[model samples]
Target: MTADTNTDLDTAQLPPPAEKSARALARARKRRSVARFWREYRTHRSGLWGLAGLILIALIAICAPLLVGADSQSVTDAPGGALEAPSGEFPLGTDQFGRSVLALLVWGARVSLTVGLLAAFLCVAIGTVVGIVAGHFRGWYSTVLMRVTDWFLVMPTLVLAIALATVMSRSIWTVILAIGVTTWPTTARLVRAQTLAVESRPYIERARALGGGHRHIMLRHVLPNVMPLVLAQTTLVISGAILTEATLAFLGLGDPTITSWGGMLQDAREAGAVSAGDWWYLAPPGLAIALVALAFTLCGRAIEAVLNPKLGVAR
Candidate 1:
């Protein structure tokens, strides 16, 4: 009996299975989720294509400096003159300033992508906070918050963005801020709806019963469950943000220092590239914008279908 008790005590003293830290466990789960998502995404042809296109765009953006050469910034205009035709020397032709269309297109990718990603991140962060708080706390506060969200939702997004941009300086960051601030309502609404469903689940009730605080339960329990939806929405938001930035830039609201696809289009329009049938100047930037939007849309749809199985139909 003495030996058995000592053995039992030793067993009890042994550290409990060297269990992983919560952070480590969370990381492992995230890795597993990513793997699962990739496996599922593989079957989606459009999604695969979209992913490939985005990769290609990113690669182009990264390689712009190398491809554009050392004099890219200074050599905005070609010696060949404006509205030049496509040839080996001036592939994609030249703009009104005789700027290499290919160079402008590559540099434009950097601006559009940076704006889209940063603005989407800002909007998603704001929306997630508003959504989680409103959804978790039901009552007068929730009603008020939802009402505020509704007010924003009912407003014309582009109009509000344009107003904001007009009020602020004409810069890339200003445009990003305008779009981010104006676009959060839709994301907030989506997150709130998902949060409500998550809050009503049995596990959430148990977490509450176990003396979990509001912050603890909401962050530790609720947020993870709603993240897939948030991620899917984020992709959609990026596409919208890109389009919004383009619209703003096209309307002469863009930073004069930067050259974006929309700015290219605006310049082309002003130069009568369309009327003159300068397809090279007009098509490359337009195609870049469309391709980016289409890629994000495809990815968002695929993620939505996979995460929200109810929406997964034969497509």
Candidate 2:
């Protein structure tokens, strides 16, 4: 090849080297971001452990039924199966009807997780809309919306939930709906505050001056800024909803057909498992609920620290 051609080839090869360097730098930055998140996460040791415990419980819940090869509610009328202690045959023992407590705990995890996640999503959707409208549009609109929020805020959630569950029918979906509806008020209040703050920012004014539509500014600008708060609140709300569902189920407001942790607890209580000294019957479900709630609470706190660096405990 000619010297000129060789020189051009060399230049082309140099650009590839530069491109590789840029790519490497980008990857390094991504790694740093991940490391920073974990570092922040580790700052809150309790929260991290909580998240780990929750994840463990969820995994167990998801895998339990598959491992056991028995339906959560299956009744085995084997002699001496009822209220058996933890043994090789039955890890967490058997219920009054000879159902494996371990199996029920696992299946119940699925139900509780599903309810928590679904209810949290519902709350975020309804709350975001209400918050955006109330915060973005002041005067009569804001006043009316705020008043409605107040009405919900004043109602006792558990009491209202019982009434709703009684009226609507004792099902998982009903529990989800009741918990979701009642839970949105707190998120709405939080989102509204964030929306107001975002609306007052200089960029929002710039967007307005640039002839951006209200919808565009709100969705692109305000919503993005407030998303962190929404996410944190979502985690907290999910934990609360899960607990509430369990409480309702414990009170016999849950679907009889479902094998939920709460329902299991209710059954145990009704059968006098505690009084009869059947620790296996009550322990698994109760521990599952507590561990799941603890996990959510920790995750929420971790996310809060990540979103707000000032509050982050230093590693």
The alpha-carbon lDDT assigned to residue 17 of candidate 2 equals 73
Q: How far off is residue 172 in model 1, in Å?
A: 0.8
Winner by lDDT: 1
lDDT of 1: 0.89
For model 1, how does the per-residue alpha-carbon lDDT over 1-315 read when each residue is reduced to its tens digit? 699999999998866654547667879998998999888888888888888999999998989889886455444435567789998988888887777888889999999999999999999999999999999998998999999999989999999999999989989999999999989998899889989999889998898898999999889998999999999999999999999999999899989788899988998999998899999988998889999999999989988888877986344
Every model's TM-score: 0.91, 0.85
Candidate 1 worst ten-residue window by lDDT: 70-79
Least lDDT summed over 10 consecutive residues: which range in candidate 2?
Answer: 71-80
What are the runs in model 2 whose C-alpha is more than 4 Å off?
Answer: 1-39, 76-80, 312-315
Each model's lDDT? 0.89, 0.85
